[model samples]
Target: EQGHEERKSGTLSEPQEFHSGFIRINPDHPDRVLHQDIDNIENIRSFISAARAAAFSKPVIAIKTGKTAAGALAAEIHTGGKQSSDAVYDALFQRAGMLRVSDLTELFAATQTLAMHPKLLKVEQLTILTNGGGPGVMAVDSLLQSSGKLAQLSEETRAALNKVIPQSDMTSNPVDIFGDSVPARYQQALEILLHAKEVKNLLIIHTPSALAPSEDYALIIAQTLDKLPKMARPYVITNFMGEDAAYAARRLCSNYGIPTYRTPEGAVRAFMHLVSYRRNQKHLTQTPESNADDAKINKHAAKALVNEFLAEQQSYLSTHQASQILAHYGVECIQTEVAYTPTEAKEQAIELGFPVALKLISPSIPSKSEVGGVVLNLNDAQEVEQTAFAMLLRIKNTYPDAIIEGFSLQKMAPRAGANELRIAVKTEPNFGPVILLGEAGTGLEFAQAAVALPPLNMNLAKYLIAAAHDKGVLKERVLPEKVDKYRLCALLTRISQLVIDQPDITSLELNPILASNGQFLVLDATMTLSRYQVQSHRKRLSIRPYPIELVKQVTLKNNTLATLRPIKPEDEQAHQEFDQSLSKEDRYKRFFGELPQFNHDQLAKMTQIDYDREMAFIITQDNATLGVSRVLMDPDKIHAEFAIVVRSNCQGLGLGSLLMRAAIEYCQSQSVQFIEGITLPENTGMIELARKLGFKISRDFEEGSINMVLALTPIDKHG
Candidate 1:
């Protein structure tokens, strides 16, 4: 309706609309041409913005159609518009903190489930309680298929269940109370599972039976859950089978704030949806450690080499050139030497050592081993020379016009127990630079690889590693010693920072990066260059990265040096301390009420903010936060709300003025039309600061507050 209003008022500029139910944005809709601007890549990101904004306040259950090739074609034909890569859509939805459901059944099931019990589960494990064995078994199967776990009942819990459940075979995880049991039996079984420390989510399944009605069983479960404090125990979900008999029970469960599904699979899928939603939300808010090793990286040298290749109008960098650039970024690369001729290759091999590897270096032949362009384990100079000569001949004959950059010679890597991991970066039109990691060799591995967008921190890198492990892409075998995951995460993070530091590098591939005994050796690599055009270096990312460029050094009024920068996740502790140091009156004035002690989640929400929609600049000296200024833009991006608070101990240091100025400049840069803030009338310092910053101050005597408004952009008269 809001979208309709905007369209009717001639105010709908973007091809997207967000509301309470769900946002349906089709950039390629045929009507978009008449009603919206030119559809571009930004349309997808605009959808991301809408989804994320909605997700912030409520759970967003999304249904992404056209997953298969046939479905995609059908959608294109029906809508008369092409679809972007489904994988890109998947990544965007995950990044935006939206839970994707497969069909309308799962969609409504998940929506109802989340809408009723919005609290996240403590664990992904589901403890099934069923009167029939078949529905319990079905629920178990669905749970495992969804990559979820079945709650393992402890021996003590099983012993307790044996006392109430009559059948011996039903004493396990999916405790069966027997079909002939009464409603009291279900209440007993539910209480047992509800109090079990191992159970995080409980799903009770019931089929129609003459022994007891489904509504009676649902009432008992509801009453049992109500006995405990709200959200104090594992969440209880119900699978009341059959439409005719289960209809009243389902409605009763809905009124009692319990999720009910018609099928066991639906209930389990809804529970797993909540699990996925929780994980995605964690990824959105988790604060990652800063990459401490980036200072040691030779970004300048890497940029220079990439620039040199771009200056020469060459896209592909030679093997040795690529190795050198990787080395500059602190990625351990096997020493490689380029030779113009076979004799030069032999001489280079001799200089390096015996038992070397020789590969044909040509822009056209990307996969050297595929075209007989590579030879391994050459023992002596003669073997190296002969192999190089034969490889050159084979490649030259295969592609007569292919640019042969000569041969690359390097010592052979010890292949015994080492894992060959492929790490590559590719630029997608929608998401920009994406990082791929998986097992090396063959197109099959490429198909199974896990991908993540760049600008990764330690936490995001760990998530990528975990996701790869979950997908069976990268496995850790006990034989060769465990792969150093921390080192690997650091390396991935460095590679992420490399792209941020040097945007000219359009693509990079490190094939068969050997990982053995906590060591990573880049065996063979390739890089492609393009003169990236961007207003800012990080603009290519679909999700905005931390704005390191905004960090600045400033001096306080007391001549003490301080740093004014965007807040980081690492500042949560300091922010807590800053919040606690404020006097009662100061806190009340700042918060407009008595401030409560912030919990971990609240502190995380304050510190780990999205840089795209919100900006929190803090003035810090040493290890303490002296002051903070935060600006939060609304969904429209035209108006922003501002807040500033200086530490009570450091109130007279001119920090508030500095932070407000910085925030105003930031709002101006973002093109925010108006900046608005309010403060108690007693807060004369803040009101004076607002006046100094060119803000129009208006007093509200009824509300006993002062409203400060600053127009960053000229107001339009036509609106």
Candidate 2:
């Protein structure tokens, strides 16, 4: 059971549970266990749900390998076609907040580190503690290799370290305590490292030596960590050298929740997982600005275009048709007209004045540039007709099998910036529709693109657009204004939404996307649709998008019209004001204590919720937050803790009742078994509200609180 032993257990090995988990990273266990029940979907769902529930206590990682011919056969024979596509698995893991790694080494290291310090979210730098110089250098090399940073010792920290270990022999970042070290000396260094603000992670490396206090060294570190407060303790991992001298030391470290790796590389890699976790979680909560109208798409018009193309038995859209689709969704595209004859090409080219481009549009040829099917800078009608005739002859000679539909006459748009970018939505065999951002065309062959999942909001869209910034292509802005990053981000978000709305679309590409003075336009596009209906058991998307469909209007008992919708990331500022507007008494009634005001971190947590298992609905009259109803679901998916609060002025206006009904309906729809909450015993209004909402109310004398429980449905146990 390599890397299978639970880090929480003190022992080296424990009795392995056959139903331990879906450990996809384990290649040693090569045999794929085939569950016999083919149609027992409930059984599989219950099992997966339970596994996800366990993962909530810590991060869970999985790697799905073997998608080739032989591997697919093994999978099909094992599961009897019960295995949903890997895209569904990605969505499932995202909903669970599980980190999906690509290798076994990463899986074990990340799992061990997270288990040791669940609250250790991010690592800016590491305070390395070591005995020998060689081992110290090894630790530093590993950390830097994993993209880890070394904390610079402040003057005060340097002075303290000098006092603990003589400055003559000390290294800067690694803070070497010399080859012959004692437990007392290590403790002194530990005190200085822990108090230093520059360090967020700690790595201790010690090579086996007769002079080293091997057993006492681990014991001292453990005892010191036990005394420090939870928040004060940084992420700590130790490399205790050899098996002979480090056995007892390893046990002591494990017992105290310290991850002990046998090698420096392993320890540093484990710490990097903490860094990755922090970065990913922060991105998840970031709420960038976006207009409400930005998401509004012409669904009817887009659908009609797709229907027309499919009716003609065409699997792919022409450049003209693709541009039309982009226009319907408010995306700017180069003007294009399909020219049937050389005369038609001359006519459209004349209307464009000058500097037009001609592209051969064919059902069989998706990439026209590949076969010299495009010609630019046709300044006059004569050139347009001449190039159009030559283009037809060349296509016949070069690509004889390519079905030449018609030639597209497009206006040659000028550029604001010299750079050309490509944005695409291509279905991956494993991750479903992945957004690709890079330098468009043949240039992107060697230059890697930034890839992300679909259903992106503004924040994620920004992340994808800025992906090429590190490659030095984005900085060469020739225009007076810098690249309109927000506009570019909005474009990616629109494309993401388009793909989510249209599942039959297998691939969409926008090559040589031009951006000038904050304006963006697509020069060319090609899209393909699936011929047969997709028959995966999973939905089109794993990550749930913004619930615009969930928005509803309701008239209160006072005849006051109120609109309710799921909370958005942009609601952080409004939420802060809502908190301040609450009276002291009302705050105590709602939060179980006085919350004078929510800090920035508190505000972000309330605004940016992972909508898969959590949801908050707010009622507004005129864009002001009037009341909020929220639910925090248990990982089990059966139980949820729900609460609602209305503004003091809005109370007693039937707002609370409306919110309560919505919460119950939401819980029932999600298959939540029950909802429960606790409030102060003195809060009679809440007790009355609960009783009216069909909740069983009871007083807890021991805790001096009122308990309310509402059973929505029964859990379906696997039979």
Candidate 3:
């Protein structure tokens, strides 16, 4: 509990200041209780949640040791804490917005670098300024490994740099300022690079030189940064390449608020940390596109099928059964027919019109091709009958008691220039439902699969697709027409919705989902079932899904019908329009000052909220948002600060009260202790509304604001 407080408070303490947190886990130790009493998965998640609390957006680095079998054995013996798959840990860290490092060195490097420059907000290319060619090359290699870009020096910057360095080659990025160059040369080149729009990030590598101490070059760089205004200075990192000779120089740069590394690789790794941190922060608030088809989803039909399967004690659904479940959710699959015997198989293939593919169905045989249980392109009924009989005989000879349930036949998918892809859903012991996508082939492994947690919106689905493309799981091809990415993303989003809506689905796979001629068809699909006992489907997810249950229809004082529900990312435009309709005085009362239109990021931050720790209730009449009330919960989940606003024209119609009541009800349900807010003293209408809501109101003379506090649940001081 104490460790939890520290992790939560690490950034919450002084949110105005950037605080980078690091955690190192060593399962092997002399004292078992000291380093070992943790459920690796859950505790790691708790730590990540605390670090990623909406109150702060700082980089958190984690180092989990004991990844190998030998280390796992030691961990098990020492702490009785079993190890989990390292890949799962990697995916969790990535999805949860934490940076996972291999060791203390990387953890420290990332934490220190991010701590020094916490506002490094972009993923711009890096420009390396080095005294040695070898170290510069090493930096370039590490940069690419980290998925970083190397900046190309503009001709203008390069020309200016050439005048100072006097070497044509030295003017380019990784601008090799000759080893024996004077210290002022570093300052001159830095000034020119700082002005260049291309040089967003700068890495200076200074190896030991006989002509001048590394300290002099470091001093010059430090003095140059100190003289410039903080905002005018470009992002900078330094690598002083020796232990003793460079220690003082490294220390000097650190004192000037510049990050320094012992090696170029270390510096590049640190830069990537910042890059990942910024990108992850944006993803944290990414608004998923609202699916209009959500209303069309036949969740009941899918649920009834799952119930029937479970009641029949059938864990794995038959090919046809799985296809029906998918059809309920609008996932397209190649039509297939099942046959219980060789005669039936031939008849079914004939009915389907041949040029068909026949696959064996058995719980024991996961891969039909490996057991000679799959035959394709059978042109005639005779060939189909013969192939089916041969496949049954071959499987029976290999395994005497193999359960040969039957065979399934589908029209052969067109294969010329088409791409086969796989999308699957599996239940992870800790992370719950995980969605996977990859190139379809024999023996697919999770290590090679692109993973994303479920309840994905279109935006989140796009991110998953992007990750798949980056990992080479999804490829771009000109043949058979380029894959319709929009359609593919929509399919993925629907698949995710299927997983989210059906808790009984323990596993699902759409393998060899043929993508050709601008169409995506699921060639083969399998689904496994389990009893759904969890009270809420959202509980099964690491990330909370949207709260559809919170949506309610209410009539205001004037009998104006409106919907009071949680706001969605898709409401950004409507939200903006609502804000603009507010009178200046009403806006001031809400925002505490005259407000301008919000930019995309600010609006995204407002609409794309984390449902786990926050709630925003927007009251809408027809399709227009009338008012919104939102509350941001603290780390402890005890106190929440709220803000409420209503359209000026809609005022006095009870929209504010309706929205506020909805927010309070949500807080009370979440067991939040207090919901508080501050308003200008001049806003008597809001003050009266708060008072009527049973809040204890007080005036703060110093700030000239009214404080409204409502204690929904009392705290247990003794407990």
Against the reference, the lDDT scores of all candidates come to 0.77, 0.70, 0.76
Estimate the TM-score of every prediction: 0.90, 0.78, 0.88
TM-score of model 1 vs. true structure: 0.90
Q: Highest TM-score among the candidates is held by which one?
A: 1
Task: Give the better candidate number (2 or 3) by TM-score.
Answer: 3
lDDT of 3 at 129: 90
lDDT of 1 by residue, 1-719 (tens): 00111121111343333321123333332221111121233444455555565555556666667778898777667656666566556656677777776776665556555655555667877788998889989998888877888878999899989888877667888888878888777788889888888987889899998977888988888888889887577887788999888888888887777777888987888788889988877766743433538665887888888888788898888668887787776798898999999999999999999889898888787787788877889999999988888887777788888888888888998889887888988777656777888888755223477777666888888888998898789887766577788989989988888877787888888887888889899888888898987643235766666787788899988998999999999899999999898899888888999868889989988998877668999999888999999999875568899999999989888999899998888888887899999999899999998998889999999998999999996432210
Which candidate gets the maximum lDDT versus the true structure?
1
Candidate 1, after superposition: displacement of residue 61 in Å? 2.4
- Candidate 3 per-residue lDDT over residues 513-545, each given as its tens digit: 888776789988888888977543225766666
Candidate 2 lDDT by residue in tens digits, 1-719? 11333333111111122123432213233222111111112232233433343333344455554334576467667545534444344333443444566566665566566655555355568888888788788878887876668888788888878887876447488988987767788889987887788767789887776765577888888888888897777767888888877887887787776788888877777777777556544554643222324555786688788877778877887667888777777788888888888889999888877899998888777678877788888899999998889988888888788888888888888763445778877765424566777766743321356665666777777765654564443455565656677877777777877776677778888887887767777888888887436544444453456777668999987898989888888888988888988989989999888666889877887887656557799998887899999997765567889899999988888888888887777887778889998989877887899999899998899988999999996433210
Model 2, global lDDT: 0.70
Task: Tell how far residue 399 is off in model 1, in angstroms.
Answer: 3.2
Q: Which residue pairs overlap in candidate 1's backbone?
A: none
Worst 10 residues of 2 by lDDT: 31-40
Q: State the displacement of the C-alpha of residue 441, model 2, in Å, after optimal TM-score superposition.
A: 1.6
